[model samples]
Target chain A: MDQLYTPSTEKCELVSASKGTVKFLLDYSKSLSIVKAEGMVFENNLN
Target chain B: MEHQTDDSTLVQDYISGDERALEILINRHNQRITSFIYSKVLDRDAAEDIFQDTFIKVIKTLKKGNYSEEGKFLPWVMRIAHNLIIDYFRKNKRMPKFEGGDDFNIFSVIGDEKPNVEKQLIKDQIDSDLSMLIDELPDDQRDVLIMRIYKDMSFKEISECTGVSINTALGRMRYALINLRKIIQKNNIVLTNY
Candidate 1:
């Protein structure tokens, strides 16, 4: 997971990025009845 | 003063093997892009699938050194998502079938039957023509028409999406149809074969 700062906040809090991307890839994998993207970009590429 | 990295810079960074840049870019636009897809598909799973597919295409294109949109990243992604949505509809053969309604029925205007190849060709032509006519409508009315007709969203869903009352959504839809008819007549574009 990549640590990124909040864009608009003044405090500059650290946050874990790619949560949505991970979930999206997981959902997509499930939809295709696959465990993961395998050799695709999302396989171990996301947090 | 805080400085924000623009999308083009982020794209370049991601292309240069900085995966964190891609994460930031995805996180930044996730909600808007996902919501836009969901509004069109009206299904969470399908929306997520399309979103994933959209990014997959983006990554491939970028990796292949074909990322030429530059500053206009979001619009380019949205266009890809829009085409994917059209593909989903085409694969499922789920064209809108409007129920009997008030003075105007959009389905009747753009006949959706594909009984023969000739009718299918005509329907395709009408769809192409209607897409152009739709572009001329006022933004609000166009939004309503797309949500109601293309997205197959109900008035309540349209109301929630547009942050307007259901009545307001319905009114916009009516006006959209009314104006669409007027535009067709004014332009002398025949939408129906009969």
Candidate 2:
């Protein structure tokens, strides 16, 4: 147990550390929206 | 296995007129960063809006040749997300509420008696940084830690949920903390109060 678990002395300040996985999938349409938005940014930057 | 390009190299490539580099970077980090923002906002449209705004800022910064964050691209982008989340809350005049009982409130731990945006934002930035570090943990350990800390579950509850014994649950929690410390040190992440 000692070798497996070394207790951390660092203070825990996280309010809540939930799971990192997104609940909703990014899906194709939403991703395309982002791509479209990026295209607009590139176009504007060029203009 | 195929070789995956590191974020800094991709960022440099994007800066040097390689459009594909930016696409790869965005696609690589899109899920995690979007999940982070969505977790905070809890509104799909708002989260997506902020995500777009974040990349827009990233593009502007890179285009102006002011992108000096070196290899720390994800954290820098997360900071931008953090600021945008704060802005979203300020504009809406509210904060994201934890969905559990009175066991813990994130705002309580991070906020003052009176609402202080600056302190809250700073603490939120630290929390966001910590969240990124937490992502580095093994899935099993991360599941145990999230159940124990975020869900406020007991060892017995965690064991029951994960179909393991209470002792195993406790062991995983312990290992989670130990590994979290190692990851923090390895990444040079500062989790202290500013």
- Chain A only TM-scores, each candidate in turn: 0.33, 0.17
Model 1 regions lying over 4 Å from their true place? A1-47, B1-3, B94-194
Would you list the C-alpha lDDT of every candidate in the order shown?
0.75, 0.72
Using TM-score, give the best candidate's number: 1
Q: Write the per-residue lDDT of candidate 1 for residues A1-47, one digit (tens) a residue.
A: 33575454422323221467656643432233212245544323332
Output the lDDT of residue B95, model 2.
54
- Candidate 1 residues B25-112, lDDT tens each? 7777777787788767766677778888888877667665678965499999889889999998897676653446677767565875
Considering the two chains of model 2, state its CAPRI-style docking category: incorrect
Report lDDT (Cα) of residue A45, candidate 1: 37
In model 1, state the lDDT of residue B169. 92
Error of model 2, residue A45, in angstroms:
3.8
